[model samples]
Target: MVSRLGFLGVIARLFMWAFLLGLAVVVLYPLLWMVLNGFKTNAELFGNPFALPTGIDFGNYRDAWNRGVSGYLATSVLVTVTSTVATVFISAWAAYGLTRVDIPFNKVLTAVILGGLMLTPTVALVPLVRMFQSIGLYNSFWALLILYTAFRVPFTTFLIRAYMIDLPREVDEAAQIDGAGRWTAFWRIILPMCKPIITSTVLLHVLFAWNEYLFAMVFTNGSDVQTLPVGLTSLMSKHGTDFPVVFAGMVIAAVPVVFLFLFGQRYIVKGLADGVGK
Candidate 1:
């Protein structure tokens, strides 16, 4: 009976490996195809989409970069980085307050913050556009930054608050007993202890603010404040026939996000698991 059970376990393991192998191939092939096709000319690409490029072509990348990708990249970096910082900072503080404080109407405030999660961006687009324009923020980098930060704060606050709520209350009490003020304890102790959740929140904000399209499209004009997604669309439209250059531009735009995920993936998984599971 034991031998039969072992045999079944081995078969299950093999089947699992095969399934994962196929899944990996399915996920990776499109990315590999895009990168490889980026090296092929229009003739080469249309002639044989599946075939490897005859030679590596740096010219496509160079041309793609020259054609305003550089500017778009800079703008995306600025908006993503700034917005992520602002979102995480503001959200972290709010989370700390709601979880740790005994303020009057704290429950009402918590409900209000969580209520933001129900809002879909499209519902508020017209009003947001009008408000930003009235405030002279339309078609500017600040428009995207403010919009991204505002939209992201509520969810981020919730995540951090979850993790914070699960944290040991003894730590905060001990800090207070030792003469540490709330601000000092938050900055010096609580924030450090909340590193895992903070990392998760930062990565989430980065991914959202980096790849977001609708706000990037609506909030900024294409000239100076356009982000990578909108920029990529414009690139495609302008060089509609230049598949190689467009592919190169896409690969460039994707590289940063891929690298970020690879580096922080461990922290992201751990933080989210701890924050959500407990």
Candidate 2:
């Protein structure tokens, strides 16, 4: 009887594994299809969507690389990189100050910052556009950069501060006794210690900025300044029925985000577990 129960348990577990594996394939099949179709001619693609390409046609990649999408990708990289760095730095400093400093109404200020997370950016687009226009940053890269950094800061700060609040207070005290100022301790000790959470936050913000379409479209007008998501829309409108080129652009657009998510997943999990009580 004991041997029979054990064998049945193993079978059940295997069934569970197979179910989950099937589910994963189900979820990922569309992405796989998109990528594979990019390498096939239109007829070959539509005729047999699931079949492998007869011959690997690299034209899609070449066309995408030599055209508008490549430059758009460069713009995306620039914006996402700069905005992620700015958001992380400013958020780290703000979180460190909020956690370490003994200032009046600090709690209130932290609450205020946290409240920004509650407000959706879409709701504030008109006023924000006007504000940026007045400040001479509208329709430019700086506009997108500033908007990305500002909108991302609240959650990033909240994440960092959650982790910061849990750190050992003794480190800060010891540094102070050694004549280290708040900035010195934060820069030298606390910042270094929060590398995992910082990395997670930066990666998250980069993905967000890279994928965001509503703000990018509203704020950026020039082709030279447009990022991948916005540029892809223009490409689609101008290249109707050119599915291969569109798919090619889509693949190029997905590269950074896919790579980041796959590689930074561990840190992302760690940060969420530590910061948001996950």
Prediction 2 TM-score vs. true? 0.93
Instruction: List TM-scores for all candidates, in order.
Output: 0.96, 0.93
RMSD of 1: 1.3
Candidate 2 backbone overlaps, count:
0
Error of 2 at 99 (Å): 0.9
- Which lDDT tens digits does candidate 2 get at residues 1-278? 99999999999999999999999999788888888888988788778878987888889888877779988988999999999999999999999989988888998999999999998998999999899999899889999889899999999999999989989999999998999998899999999999889988987888799899999999989889999999987656544466777788899899778888998899888877877673
Native-vs-model 1 lDDT? Answer: 0.92
RMSD of 2: 1.9
